[model samples]
Target: MLVSEVMLQQTPVTRVLPIWQEWMDRWPTPAALAAEPAGEAVRAWGRLGYPRRALRLYAAAAAITADHDGVVPDSFDGLLTLPGVGTYTAAAVAAFAYGRRATVVDTNIRRVQARVISGSALPAPTLSAAEMRLAAALLPEEGAQSAKWNAAVMELGALVCTARAPKCGNCPIRSECAWLAAGQPAPSYVAKGQPWAGTDRQVRGAVMGVLRATRMPIQRELFFAPVPELGDDGLDGTTFSESLRSQLRRLHSLMAPESQLERAIEGLLQDGLAQSREGGLLLPD
Candidate 1:
């Protein structure tokens, strides 16, 4: 439950399932993961978007092994003390894994709650105190009921009450939906999606990809190869092969700008995702 919860944060289950399964097969216990270097966890993370979560999970495993006697903490507060574990994750684990009566408000639950009770097109940009209070209040009195309600509400949001193209006709609670009652107004404010193209995140991801692809330290110069301009290379658009075009496109991404690559490498080093070795860089050990 903890692994799935951590992996599922802003990431789809389809992307997470195989990685989670492989992770479980490799390190079935806290002790097993704790015994390995943190870098192994990052390598295993394998393009999961946010790589820092891998380090946090590794740290949590080590803490669990050393402090919790190699067992996952059942209590919400105890779980929160683990690295990378937050209020949502702690509450989720308590309610789902241990059958505790937790409020358990995930993204899905928040959306469901907003449409069903608050008559809103979407949740607030951030979770508000009132929303948290409402979630707690709506939780069922009994532990088992609370757990089931959590799953049902979350599923309803993920499937039928999606952010875009909500299947209102298929929603089980459409009859009582406050959003539907209010005539399905537009969201007061749509959150801007994070940009990826040509951004530092893309450059950083590319750097991480390079590091993850090799065991040996890569020379700094390797990341600074700027893509050659087609005309400058004496190749016009019509002369370039599809395979070469693909390679150039990939090269353009790998070598963003020398400054961007430098920033990415520095950020990765500072984040402890990569280490500066003998005049080169590699994943931390």
Candidate 2:
């Protein structure tokens, strides 16, 4: 449950499924995972996007093995103490894994809550105290029933009451949906997709990609990948052949500025995702 929750965060299920199965097969128990080096977890993360979650999971495993006798915590508070666990994750683990009643709100549940109770097209960008109180109050009194309620509401939002192109006719609570009664007003704020192309995240991921491909320390220049010094006779682009220009563009696309590369490596070192090794860089051991 912990692994699935962590893997599912901001990642599509199709992308997470196989890697998750591999992880479970490799480390069925917290102690089993804890026995491996932290770098192994990052190596096995395999394009899950946020590799930090891998390190956090590794840390969480070590914590569980050391502090909880190698068992995943059963209580919401106990789960919250895990390295990457937050309020929603804690409540989700308690409710879904242990069948304990909790205010298990996530994006889907929040969306459902907004449309059903608040008569809004969407929930706020961040979770609010009012949303928390409402979710808590809406939970069923019985633990098992509340757990089911959480799953049902979240699934409804995911499948039928989706943020875009909701299947209103299929929604079980369509008649009671406040947003429907209010004539399905548009969201007050515009939704935006996260930027990705050429961002620091791309540079960082590219650097990590190279590091993940090998166990050996990587020379820093590989990331900076500076173009060979154009000498005094430096042929300008206009003087170069078409093929040369094409190759130059391809090479340029693979390189980052020295400053950005340094910043990325420094940030990785600070995050414990990387370490200096023999005058080069490598993932943490």
Candidate 3:
């Protein structure tokens, strides 16, 4: 779960659930994931935005297998040592899996903390020592109960105390919330948002999606391959050739910068998401 959290940062939960299930089912144990080729791990990552997380997860799996006998470590320090396991993930795993009392602060938790404790719409750029101290002060004395409380607070922020428009009336903590008491002061900080369309990231994602959806390797030439020779098209070869060229142009526009796309393609081949075989591109079995 902790590993999944790290991979899923800034990604939508709807997309993360299926990937997480597929990953855990295939690996099941850390040792199982460790035994697979690193390339296989990358291929399994599919269209998750950050490809590097796949590599980190593979490394973390290996560390768990070699050092901890495949059991995910229970201590905060131990979890922190795993690749891609940051402070948030380490604390979350320790609290949730090991029943330790720790403040698991993510965006959701930060929102709740900011609104209720500080009467703000959002928090500082990063979690600070003061924020940690304040959160820790609120943790329940019992370890197990503290974990449950932490989860509850985060869940509330996700479902109700949303960043855009919090439903103050139904909030369990509304009566005591500083922000609510102060009439929900306006957000002091602007939310950082990234555009989606026409970005290289989007194009890269589309390329990966195409690879994953295919059963056989696609040809590098066929990337814009003439519509799979549509059975006896009434239009004939001349018209088809013109259409193919147009389609290729459109696809080229949608892909990454020429050099970047070439590199991404090469990386995919190296990672086993793609393979070059006898003048064709293919997904590995």
Candidate 4:
């Protein structure tokens, strides 16, 4: 479950379920996953957004095999000591796997808690120590049932009290919800997101899609082929340079004009996907 939770980071659970099952089927235990090549894991990742989580999971599995005898740690501190494990993962494993009374808060749990308990329409951007303490307070008294309670709250938040359009009338906790009691206060902050269409992220996803789907890197021209459509919707000849600038241009042309395409490219470089050498853009091995 820890492995699935980490893999599901920034991803919808519905999308991660099949991939998670496939991974566990292929590598039933930590020792089995540890023996496989990290590249194989990344290949199996299949467009789950942040690809590095695949690598991190590989590393964590190997670490567990080497240091912990292939067992997922039972303690929150022990889980936290593992690679890629954080507060949420640690608490989640403790609560769900070990049946500890730890407070487990994800986006769903957080939003539900904020709206139902805190009387806020939305949660703070990030979890705080005080918020954790508050979540701990809401845990059912029985340690054995704590995990079920946590899961129930999170499920309620995800299915009924969703961010965009909450169905308060159908909510199981609607009667006790603080926000509903307060007449459904308006959200305080603006919903923020980079538009998907014609954005650098879209181009990057396209580029990564092309690269990951194939065994080898493709030529620069293959990506920057001319498009009949004008504006950011189409790739133009000017973006076909074999240089880094052209690589950036191809992504920029696809992205919204306001997007930070250059910075996103730099992030890819830092992650070792695209490299600049001999005045040409190339994918890393």
Cα lDDT tens digits, model 2, 9-82, are 88888899999999999999999999998999999997798999999999999999999999999999999999
Cα lDDT tens digits for candidate 3, 1-285: 766776668887888888889988898888898888675776788767776678778889999999998899999889999988988889888988889987788888888999999999888877888888888888899999999988998899999999787898899878899988898789887878789776656655555655554444445654443444433322223222444344334556574566666766777766655667666565553
- In terms of TM-score, which candidate is strongest? 1
Off by over 4 Å in 2: 227-254
lDDT of 4 at 137: 88
C-alpha lDDT of all candidate models, in order: 0.85, 0.84, 0.75, 0.74
Number of backbone collisions per candidate: 0, 0, 5, 4
lDDT of 2 at 189: 98
Better of 2 and 4 by lDDT: 2
Residue-wise C-alpha lDDT for candidate 1, range 99-151, written one tens digit per residue: 99888888888999999898989998898888899998988999989999888
Residue pairs whose backbone atoms clash in candidate 1: none
lDDT for 219 (candidate 3): 50
Candidate 3 colliding pairs: 217-281, 217-282, 218-281, 219-281, 222-225
Candidate 1 lDDT for residue 205? 80
Residue-level lDDT tens digits of model 4 in 26-125: 9999899888766577767877887767777888898899999889989988898887788888888899888988889888888998898899999987
Could you give the C-alpha RMSD of every candidate to the true structure, in order shown? Answer: 5.5, 6.2, 5.5, 6.1
Candidate 3: minimum summed lDDT over ten consecutive residues — where?
A: 231-240
Candidate 1 has its poorest 10 consecutive residues by lDDT at 231-240
Can you give the lDDT of residue 180 in candidate 1? Answer: 96
